[model samples]
Target: MRPLRNIFAAILLLSGAALWATARADDGAGRTPTPHPPRAQGEHCVADTDFMRRNHMKMMMAHRQDVLHEGVRTPQFNISGCVNCHAVKGDDGKPVSFASPQHFCRSCHTYAAVKIDCFECHNSRPETDGKAAATEIDGEDAARLAAFLRETKQ
Candidate 1:
């Protein structure tokens, strides 16, 4: 009976050690990488209706055809809606002079435990003009673009 008790205790200790080792192996060197959350789907501003409504910001309404007819190409990637206006440029021709809490999306998200990775792939500034012109339309392009934006919804 004494021998059986000793064997059982040894088996339990070995099993416990094995579990500890596996847990440490899975965790690695105590600096596990945090996984980023999936990006928001669809157009950036299109799904921000609630945000726009709360902030009293104007919503972009132009359709693809309207934008093309007006000679305005929609930006491919933009973090802030209408970034051309919101972002301030410096003498160096770079976007914004300083980074703020408003711009540091990761800060609040980190506090809330939501991970974001916008800075990894996107530039802080918005892309405006392209190297080659796609098409040419009549009338004032800016005015047409504004009008087109005024008529579209998400």
Candidate 2:
């Protein structure tokens, strides 16, 4: 009877250890630790750090249609706003572009295994203040577009 009692006690101890281990594992799975946001040279963000960390994607998505379709550009949601602040300078003092992992966006995106397509169509660096708005459509294309619009109106 004493041996039986000892066996039962051993089993209980093992079961408790197993339960503790399982609970600890489940806690981790529920919220895997995220990598810390990279420190940029800029001290402040457009939004609070916590808010930006959580909902930046949603903010950018909403701003895209507003800016692109409506031509309503605002400082707060401009992609250049982010680049101007977040871009890390290279050895030459020019910014490292989004293609590099050292870039603020790429660092987090790479850690999360997320691929962003924004840079494919947009400039990765902040545009120079002296530079005029450069359009991809050249003079011939502009004239052709004007002619098409005129012909369609008639």
Candidate 3:
């Protein structure tokens, strides 16, 4: 009976080791995905690539506060400028919306598993008339959107 117990314990130990090795191999098997955002229409970005990569969120949030609270809008660090310059065109030659994986913002945000609400209030595609598009949510829809956002926050 003691020998049988030892054998069962060895089997469990071996099985656990095998499972751990398999899981470790699986975890390291794939190459990490890197984002290759679409090229800008202009020759240069407002800032260099490295700087933008590291600080764009900070700059954009500051810019948003300036625009919304202070009535100050600058061409530099403007999100509309970003959408216009970095617009990724679809097969139809129209700018792709955020729903498309090829959308400029999604290229990085999706790769990072980051959820952005910026597009919920702002247009993902370039503006046709050089004006920010305004989308009005009705009472029921607004409530639903609010609930959805609350759920996603968790």
- Per-prediction tally of clashes: 1, 0, 0
Q: TM-score: which is higher, 1 or 3?
A: 3
Task: Please list all clashing residue pairs in model 1, or write none if there are none.
Answer: 61-152
Query: Per-residue lDDT tens digits of candidate 2, residues 2-93?
Result: 99999999999999999998998877654545555557556677789889888999999989989989998888888877876776766677
Q: What are the runs in model 3 whose C-alpha is more than 4 Å off?
A: 1-32, 129-154
Candidate 2 residue 9 Cα shift, in angstroms, is: 19
Query: Clashing pairs in model 3?
Result: none
Root-mean-square deviation of Cα positions for candidate 1 versus the true structure, in angstroms: 15.3
- Measured by TM-score, the strongest candidate is 3
After superposition, the stretches of candidate 2 with alpha carbons farther than 4 Å from their true spots are 1-36, 128-154
Of 1 and 2, the candidate ahead on TM-score is 2
Quick one: RMSD of model 2? Answer: 12.6
Model 2 weakest lDDT span, ten residues long: 132-141
Query: CA lDDT of each candidate?
Result: 0.44, 0.69, 0.80
Tell me how far the alpha carbon of residue 74 in candidate 2 is from the true structure, in angstroms, after superposition. 1.2
Best by lDDT: 3
Residue 114 local lDDT, model 2: 68
In the range 1-154, model 1's lDDT, one tens digit per residue, is: 9999999999999999999988987876355444332333235544464574344222233433445477666653223444434454445564431132233333234434433344333344444573221223334443543443344312
